[model samples]
Target: MASGADPKFEAELRRGVVQLVALDYLETPRYGYDLVRLLGAAGFPVEEGTLYPILRRFEKQGILSSRWDTEGARPRKYYELSAEGRAQKNAMLGAWAQVRDATDEALKRSMEAGQVGSPDGAEEETTS
Candidate 1:
C-alpha cells in the first residue's frame, strides 16, 4: 500500500488465473459464493468482492454466461465458461508456455553472466 506501488497486485494475480480457475470449476454449475470458497480452498487467494467482479467482467467479455436458479432458498446465479472462454483459456495456456520458456532461458543466461535473477528476468525482451 505504498505510493507508486500496485495496490491491486493481489487482485491482478487472481485475475490472471481466473480463466483457468473458472474453466476448472465449470465442469458443474457454481454459484458465486461457491466459486469464491472453492477458489480459496484451491489456494488461488481471492476475496468474494474480487471474485464477483471478475466473474461479471468475464461474463461481459463473452468468456462466461450465467443464469439464476431458484431451486435453492434464495435464487443463486450460476456461471459457466462460454465456448469463447474455453478458447481463450487454451490460447492463454499457450501464451503462458511462451512466457515461461522465455523466462527460464533468460534466467539461465543471467546466471551464466553472474547477474542476480529479477522478476520478469528478460527486461530486454520487453523492448523491440
Candidate 2:
C-alpha cells in the first residue's frame, strides 16, 4: 500500500482478470450473488458494486445472457456465457496466457539481472 507501484499494478491486474474469471465460472448458469461468493472463495474478490455493472454491460452486449429463476423463495437472475462469450473468453484466455508467459519471462530475466533500474524508473549508472 505504501508503494505507489503496488496499488497501480494490483488495480490493473484485477481489472484485467475480472472478465476472464467471471466468464470462466459463468460457463454454467449462476446468479450474481453466487458468483461474488464463488469468486471470493477462489481468492479473487469482486465487490458486488463492481461486478453487477459489468454483468449488466455484458448482458446488454450479448456476451452473456441472463434469465430469472422465479421458482425459488426469491427471484434470482442467472447468467450464462453465450456462444459469442465462449469465443471471446477463448481469445482472452489465449491473450492472457501470452501475457502471463511474458511476465514470467520478464521476472526470470529480472532475477538473473538483479534490479535493472531504480524504483523510480531511473537507469542505474554503469562504470566502464
List the global CA lDDT of all models: 0.76, 0.88
lDDT of 2 by residue, 45-94 (tens): 88999999999999998999999999999999999999999998999999
Structural similarity to truth (TM-score) of each candidate: 0.71, 0.84
Where model 1 places Cα greater than 4 Å from the true spot, the runs are 1-14, 115-128
Give the CA lDDT, 0 to 100, for residue 126 in model 2: 62
Stretch of 10 with least lDDT, candidate 1: 119-128
Q: Write the per-residue lDDT of candidate 1 for residues 4-75, one digit (tens) a residue.
A: 547577556557776576666875789888888888778676678767777888889988889999998999
The true-versus-predicted C-alpha distance at residue 17 of model 2, in Å, is: 0.5
Instruction: Report backbone clashes per prediction.
Output: 0, 0
Best by TM-score: 2
- Flag regions of model 2 displaced more than 4 Å: 1-5, 115-128
lDDT of 2 at 64: 97
